[model samples]
Target chain A: MKPDSPFLDLETAPRVAVSIDGAPLELPEGANLAAALLAAGVTVFRHTPVSGAPRGPFCMMGACFDCLVDIDGFTRQACMIEVSQGLRIIRPRDLGADDVDA
Target chain B: MSTHDLIVIGAGPAGMATASKAADLGLTVAVLDEQPRAGGQVYRDVDRVAALRGDILGADYTQGATLTAGLHHQAIEHVPGATVWAIEDGFRVSYTRAGRGAQIAADRILLATGALERPMPLPGWTLPGVMTAGAGQILLKQSGVLAKSAALVGCGPLLYLIAAQMVRAGTPPVAMIETQTRSDLIEAARHVGGALRGWPYMLKGLKMLAEITRAKVPRYPGATEIRIEGTDTAEAVSFVHRGRAHRIACRTVFLHHGVVPNTQAARSLGVSHRWHAGQSCFAPRLDVWGQSDVTGVFIAGDGAGIGGAKAAELAGRLAALKVAEESGRLSTDERDRQAAPLRSAHARELAARPFLDRAYPPFAGALAPEDATVICRCEEVTAGDIRGHARLGCLGPNQAKAFSRAGMGPCQGRYCGLTVTSLLAAANGTSHDETGYYRIRPPLKPVTLGELATLEHSAPDTAE
Candidate 1:
């Protein structure tokens, strides 16, 4: 991607291609799910139901729960969740009404 | 079934005074504090160590025992080491005690939770031996342990108090760097004239100044930079005042720019906050009676603003009186009389805070630690990481967190979120609060993995 921009030193940390939201994406070693998503410019982490307002990371820890997104098949704090190759991120609405966890 | 008509969330001057007044009205009042004893931070047992060596830190802390004992006699259940996590709707409080979760319900809630020392960042602040002045004082008072030799810095009344306390302890400070200028010291004398009715306090301030003068601790006013140097532990600190460099060869550094309202829990509850330009932090917006916009929830003491202990106590009693009026327990005349002292004290505190804040606004360099310094100790992310992400056009804290994992930690960014956000704002040349902290959500404390597993899975068709 643009000859690595001379920014990310992939030699220090290996590069890995991880699937997010079922889409293949390449990330570096030791990169967290939240950071990888942000580096790729996927800022809108989730959306609220009633008003359908877009929401993203706040507090960036498991404390806020603002960065919660459905990964693989379960809803979890994206800040706490780390990135791995071939992982899936599902949207809240896509999880269906009955399967939601509050 | 131990129930109370009202539950106050601190036993400091504010909580004690409020409980006293509330108990006088025949309401069962319960006070909870994280400390094993009352008196909060201000009246902590600092001087008792002096008594061990036969010196007078003063009688103010000792006199507080009467107020605490009086509350105890009023049938008030003072639960110590009770960390309140959240105040739910209908006044249900979920808290942790002795490492177990517990719940209690109350008719009315007063948060007199007092203030926490504002986090002032400097190079090597994350080092082991460098601590907030509050932490050092607490250690000395609570455990009879000193911080070995120390270099105390920052500008505030507490600096003078701690300096005096250190002198009395027979181990005077190696160096004391003041951020306030000689002009501010002169202004303090002038400001105390109108507040001379509290002559005892004015005299105390004078006596402290005299001690500083006599000790010749080399007061450096308008201190700009504080450089704490060490690896894994603090070895020494260096600062610049005027145009000269002053360094202290000491093992410990006690620092506090000023106090700020502890609004972490309050803000997470969606209780709106007003940015107090004076304190440079957002404090809970409260009316004269300390009633927040959230109905049935009241804030008092330093939570409303950084008034000292005296004003905090007055605010607590006044808030209770206001609550008494709203609950039909007091008439308008009674309410006015009860709140008179608080109104006056609040005015005085407000008048003094602006001058105090401006006199020592975080010495530009103290705004954020160097880019190489670790901003988030939990994730071990440095300021460089945050800056790198910012260069890639990451707009906000959330975006930066995604790129650097700076705010992701067990402490949950409570310690680092504000710092990282401030750094982001500065690097991007934006407003400070514009790069506001990460949003707070539910499960305020770290819930166990077993507990999460225990929560029943949502049904497939359920709406919530």
Candidate 2:
């Protein structure tokens, strides 16, 4: 039996407004901050010094800290950290070697 | 701690065989597992198979089932649903049972933790109706529930096995889409030729495929664009083959990119590993004896590599022989002689692997899902975000995480890390393993913040 899709039919995914590194962005309600950031055009969530590389969520789960970002000065996994209205995220400095322009 | 001669960490064929052999040698042995019943994943109790009588579980697993029952009679302590978290010095095992934590130690540790089905993500992959081929089997095994109408996607022996299982369950699938190319099958045939030494087992796989065809399930070869659609939950999937679009309407979709090694425990022990390109997963490097770089810890079965049950059982027996020899229980010559049969069986079993690998190469397009496609369902990151970060010349997965927060989700990169790594590796012109997804440290699953807070209250602080 074919059942209606909750995502398509009811759009059950909640909506949340998020700000990445002080930049305001609206995202799906209940979306994790990293996901909300990706949806809101905030791709470069943080920077790494060792190789000046772009990093994002690797293990969607907390086992991999690859998706850590600054949410109000606290380091957290974007996957694990749920997004909420008016959530303020801070982007760290020295994110990448290429970030000289930023 | 009650001392045992052997502590087998699973009750599948590998663990059972290891415990049985060690017991036969008159060594005290105990087998620990997390399943209510033994047989592990392969022999998971499929309700469909159970209804058809036990033999439907497949003879290989049925034998394992029998062996496990026999092991119980030998008085091996079988711990089910015990989440083993650590293996300390002197083979001390720390595990959590129910709501409390406990520890045990053994003379030798045999890790046959087995394998998990590799996750292959696509758009709408996180939807409710989509599930792994293994998960589908589990539902059938435990609940006797069928998908009513389902679509089976992906390739290799599991594809055929699942098809035959679905048929036997009285819920014939609507279609089966194979990603294997025709050339792959020809190559696989050559590989299968060498494995014909184990021809009886090979024929069983063939029989399953034949049954699927007779069931009138349309088979699509070299199928790409496999997708589950419907929006919130999956309703149907459409794929293109030979420049034609074929859509199947089904409530459930079962996908298998093949098996991946269960390396969390091994990695935690600091055992070095290399990413297997052909298998597209990470596996520990074990010598012929399944000994990791660590002196005493041995790994066997699918945890070493995916070679099916026969190969795994033989590997387990061989691993035990090596341990016996190392512990000075067996002479060198005697060990070699005792292991010869298993080694020969291993050679035969592995003969078909190259062909299987060729027949079941991961769909490159599928591997690198579209930028908008959801890579991390828990965090909802996309391939585009990963690629956009890669464009900034981020060299590795760690840096990618800094730039896009891709791997930092609730699932902790379990689902998306590999996918994102491949995408970033390609865009930055690096090897996938070089970018290495994430080094998994244990307590692999999430422990509630409250639970972790209480650990300090109970355990004596041994840090000093």
Candidate 3:
């Protein structure tokens, strides 16, 4: 992570190991997944299927779907997820990330 | 199915207060919310955040702890981390938790779904580095994450509060690009008398501005032609201020132009909605008691209209009292006596809204952006496309949505519904009311098929 990234790490909680886009990183436990990713210098959360454009956590609430990511093969809002051990997150794209959903 | 005397759809100030108030009135209450805690967005994760960084979030946010404390009432079931997806006739509620679905029944339903930031669609707003100011507040509250030196753009008191919050966190914003102009000020002055009745709120805003001033953050008022400029990500914010064009180099940009009622859950209920021209959005047509056209269904808080947090709490109390009386738990006279003070307090809390509405109306072009600006983030539909659909004989937002798939994303038009309505309104030369919003359907949140399969279907509640 950049020492002076635009986000400050105010979390003093113990860190846990989580994989992002297949890379391992230590993030504060129980932190919001989206905020943790951003603080860890992972801004681009997913690529839009329509235009293939990079998108991040815009609303940080569930209203904006820009923070969608694949956690254990299910597309979910990173902002809605809490950081935990062994959360495998990947930014799925192109073929429509949520096609598996009803 | 779990049954209740009343089911509250959100755990915001309104929902939380309603649950406790109704429980006090001897009505069994259930408060379901998507957050992990009781403090909706305004006070999300209030207990822990209060201990971790209460000083950074300020007293206004930490005060939510008191509201959350009431969730512990035995008569009130605080079902946190549950996203409500369906509200059927006869008070049948459907929701998802941990990718599993469940159904519950209630005699009464109160939607306190609250507000969402109005989408500030401009060139390159879809870039990875741009976010709403509300998102910044959420990060700080939920996870103690603070944006560092980001430019706070657009308008409203929220921008000031966020700038102040960041200042206190020791990572003051790089600048504030305000969109309110002289005309907005003149328009706001007409309502200043009533706004002064809300002096405490106005004072809070002033203090926030003072904090920003103390931090020496650069302020650009009356900014026009605002745009986020970059290729892969937001690199800088460019705008015209005082007739001189300037570009500020910044890696991140936080945008705001006030908030609108998050009407998705309300609209899904098929309730009547009216266009609010001042706020430039649609609000559910609700009675003074916060009851919607659908009998026994109520909407309080920002979901009914954008009346901030305190007003929502009052609305919740008033609505709960009405429900309690109608349920035969309280006498009509007693209900009125209980609601009288709440009604007055609600009025006082909302006194400044008209001024705030005019002073920081949805920024021009937000409703009708340039042809290239993407209005629908999910479908990547642009304003020009919606207008093109209008030219292609699309009559309203629904038709435009059907023609261009503008509101088909997982968000279900939460972000772009108003913009599509406005673009079509202008294109068809009709009133915004005529150019209605998308017809929001069931499963308000994206529910997987496997999740829906978990729902144990039950007949709608027959108890009136």
Note the Cα lDDT for every prediction shown: 0.66, 0.68, 0.88
For model 2 chain B, the run of ten residues with the poorest summed lDDT: B450-459
lDDT by residue (B1-464, candidate 3, tens digit) is 99999999899999999999999999999889999877889988898889888888888888999999998999988888999888898788889988899888898899999999998889889998899999989888888888775998999998998898888888899999998888998989999997899899899988888888888999998998889988877889999999899999888899999898998877877898999877888899988899999898999999988989999999999999999999999999999998888889999999988999998887785756999999999999998888788888999878777788889989888889888888878888899888788888898888899998887756543333
- Each candidate's fnat, listed in order, reads 0.00, 0.04, 0.90
TM-score of 2: 0.77
lDDT accuracy of residue B439 in candidate 3: 89
Model 2 agreement with the true structure over B254-318: per-residue lDDT tens digits: 78778777777787777788888878877898888999988788888898988877787888888
Question: What are the RMSDs of all candidates, in order?
Answer: 14.3, 10.4, 2.6
Name model 1 segments beyond 4 Å from true.
Answer: A1-102, B45-55, B181-203, B349-351, B428-433, B447-464
What is the clash tally of candidate 3? Answer: 0
Model 3 residue B448 lDDT score: 90
Which segments of candidate 2 are over 4 A away from where they belong? A1-102, B46-56, B73-75, B187-192, B402-410, B448-464
DockQ-based class of model 1: incorrect
Candidate 3 docking DockQ: 0.81
The DockQ figures for the candidates are 0.02, 0.04, 0.81
Which is the winner by TM-score between candidate 1 and candidate 3? 3
Give the alpha carbon lDDT tens digit for every residue of B37-70 in model 1.
5767666533233344224345655666656766
Please provide, for model 3 over A19-95, each residue's C-alpha lDDT reduced to its tens digit, 9 standing for 90 to 100.
87788888889888999989988878778887678899899889888999999999899999999999999887654
Q: What is the lDDT of residue A82 in candidate 3?
A: 92
RMSD of 2: 10.4
